[model samples]
Target: MCTKFYDSEFSFLISTTEIGNSQIIYEEFWFYTEFVNIFFQNTTLQEKEKERKIENVIKERKEIVIKERKEEKERTERKEKEGNGKERTERREKENLVLYKFLLEQLMNQRQKRNTPNNPRKNKIKRNENFAQKENEGSSSEEESNQFETQFQELVDSLMDSNSITRCEKYAELNHNISHYYLPIIGDFFDDTLLAVKNSLKKGSVEEQVLAIRCLLLFSITLEDAADEIFNQFEPLLLKYSLEGQNKLKIASIEALGILSYFITNTGDLDSSQKILRHCISILKNNFIPQNGGHEIYIAKVLNMCSLLLSLQANDFIGIELSGNNESDGGIFFEYIVNIGKSFLEYPDLDVRISSGRLITLAFNLKDRLEREEVVDSDIDVDAIVEIFNKLMKEYSQKVSKKTKTKQRAEFKQYISSIEECIYPKDLITIKSNKIHLEEWPKIIQLNIIRNFLGSGFQKHIEKNFLFSQLFGYRIKVESHRQKHYNKKSQRKEQKKNKKYRQQNITKERKKKNNFENQFM
Candidate 1:
């Protein structure tokens, strides 16, 4: 009989043919169940593998997005930093520009105020006659002088400002441009300006004192006479600062004293110059000892001052005895300088060595001058100096190696060349078209010192300043084309006037001769 059977696990209907044949049907059903189970299991495993693959791809995508966000954030931060830096730089530039403009405007205002007419009668005078022209020119020059004095007074007043930065700026401006204002300031306003500077020197801070010292030196250059009372008044203070003050003040005071001594010598005050030289020598002797060797710069400055003073006053010291009993010998100072130079040649500091080399060169120059002057009986020993320099040259040449600094090597070569030049003197021609030939070491040193003092104004002074022209023995008669034309026109007018005067004299003589002949007839 046929029967319907249900398999719950497989959910399939089965028919039983017979009880005996049920075993085979059951076996077949079991096989189908196992196959279905295996198939379902395989499908489930495949679906799980697909799901795992999808999850891995999603995770990779998230990671990529996260990395991209991080990169974008970093880029934005970098851009912001660059933008901030640019902003800061721009702001500084803008501030500087503003300050520059303000200063320019202030200067313009000062100029306008100075240029404004002060005297109506002077302005009303017709500039037709030569006398009037001369008067106008003189008035204009006086007005310019007044203008400069006013501007200088304003600068000095500004230096007294409460703001240190403002004071510094004004001081720098005045110092840098002192050449322009020095002549005017030295006129009627000299006393007031001097007082202001002296006050600053006495009462102001270290920076102010330094600035005042520089200003004083610049003013000292404008002094026409060597025996100016200012020298006596300021000498003690300057000496005090040079000996007692520290750092920049001491250096400035020393340089000021050197320049003062130079001016004193220039003015032919050998007594004062010699005194200054002695003072400098005494300082050097005290400072050059091993105990004070740590102050190389100070020692160098003192050496430089001695060299400058000696080079300038070498002639005076050569043949003349010291005035007082303090020093008996005449040429002993020269020997002292030579000894100092010899001792300092082995100094490690470049400045000290250079200074010593200059001192030695000056000593040799002094000896050469003495020989040229036919003063053959001097105490200076030239052979010993030559031997020392030769040794120095050999030592320097041997010390040059790959490890040597480029600056040091170049300086050494230059120093050696300068020494050789001292031995065999050569003319050092300046670079200007109107060449200044410095044939002597003293002249070279003087020019160097003046150049350092005048800075940018050196060229201007060399061209137009009478003092510099005389000092360098350079006649700079720089006439512009317009000036030449005017001169030629004036010369022609003078020639025409002379011709008319000659013609009139000749006509009068002829008339007188005719009258005499008629009377004789």
Candidate 2:
């Protein structure tokens, strides 16, 4: 039966088998079956191994992608850190540069202070030595001046910088301690400087306009050669600004116009100066309302303009020794200014009061000059002027309350003393050794005005400027050591010559006396 079952199951395989080979066929069939079974198992195992290999390959590829992504992230993170480090480095560099600049400026300032002498006597001696050196070394001094002018030209050109702060800084630098040195340079570059100033006046901000007006005033003061031209170019604009500009702009314009007019008068253009004075007076009369109180500062500024103009006119009139009726002369303006001053003597604002005081003082000075010259029959009431001053003084004294540190109080005291000096005039010797002496209040007033305008340049101008020398009746003759020694020797020789002449006269007188005595005997 087992043989039959095997034949039935393996019928296809045994189909070709013969009956004699049945046992062999059966054994062969068993071996074949075992071989087929082993082959199938091997095929299954190989397929499973192939699938496992595929899974392992997929896992390896996934790990590679993940590693690549991680590396890319790290690279990007490193790049960002490096970028941040560069930015920080750049910022630190800029800060360091700024700090370095500040330190350098401070060091330069310290060096300057160290070089400058502290004692006035030492300063004067140094100045004399410098003057002597300048006189002795002409070509070298000229070369130095040329170098200074080149530096000044660079500074003036910087006024046109696009950055307002830079322009302002340059302006301050130009107007610093040695501003007088820039006078000739400014005259040389007048047109360019005026153009820059005009541009600022036209389109710049309020602060810039104010500074530009100040520059205009500086030009008016420093450029005596271009006085008429400056007046012609700037007068209309200054008038317009005085009338139409904002508060600070108006004040600056008025001050600039006043200075310009003074220069015009100095140039002997009396008609133009009087016209400007009239215009300023009209503005003051038309615009100033004491009851309103909002325009007190404007009124004060206008008064200042009037004071400058009237003071200049009075000074010129007195200087020329003109004889005229007080009412028919420029004295009419003088009286007008006095009246305006009296009206504002009690103004609440100190500037207004001070300006009023200046006006009155100018009037008093004019009156005194007219009387001293015996030029005009005085119509101004002296007692009334004194009484008015007394009242103002009392009022100011009442305003003060033992405050030793108040600027206003101190200014008030100084103003009072100045007014007192004007009323009872005294000679004010400005510089040591009588370099500048003011015997008239008008000249003193003009000097004060100029000093305020020129600031640190005042002394330099006083010493070196011919205009100031003529105006103040002083001569600036900077002699070298050789010239001084020659002058001293000449003086000693003259003294010896006078002594010999006196001795000869004494011997001759003695001989004459003996001859007279013999005649009497």
Tens digits of lDDT, candidate 1, 67-112: 9999999999999999988996685454344334434544554565
Per-residue error at 460 for model 2, in Å? 2.0
Please list all clashing residue pairs in model 1, or write none if there are none. Answer: none
Model 2, 1-521: lDDT tens per residue?
12433344335343335587678777877887897788799999999999999999999999999999999999999999999889966854553443344335445545655697789998888778867875886665455555555666776788899998768756655555234442433555777888888777787787888887777666655544456777788788888888885788888888777777777777677767666767776776666664545677788878877777777666455322212223445555456667767878766676787777777776666666776776655366756766665665555465455442254444445445555564344445355366444655556666777887787767766755556666667776532422454465467569979999999999999999999999979
Off by over 4 Å in 2: 1-150, 177-183, 290-297, 315-334, 371-382, 396-423, 427-434, 478-521
By TM-score, the best candidate is 1
Worst 10 residues of 1 by lDDT: 180-189
True-structure lDDT of candidate 2? 0.67
For each predicted model, how many residue pairs clash, with residues at least 3 apart or on different chains? Answer: 0, 0
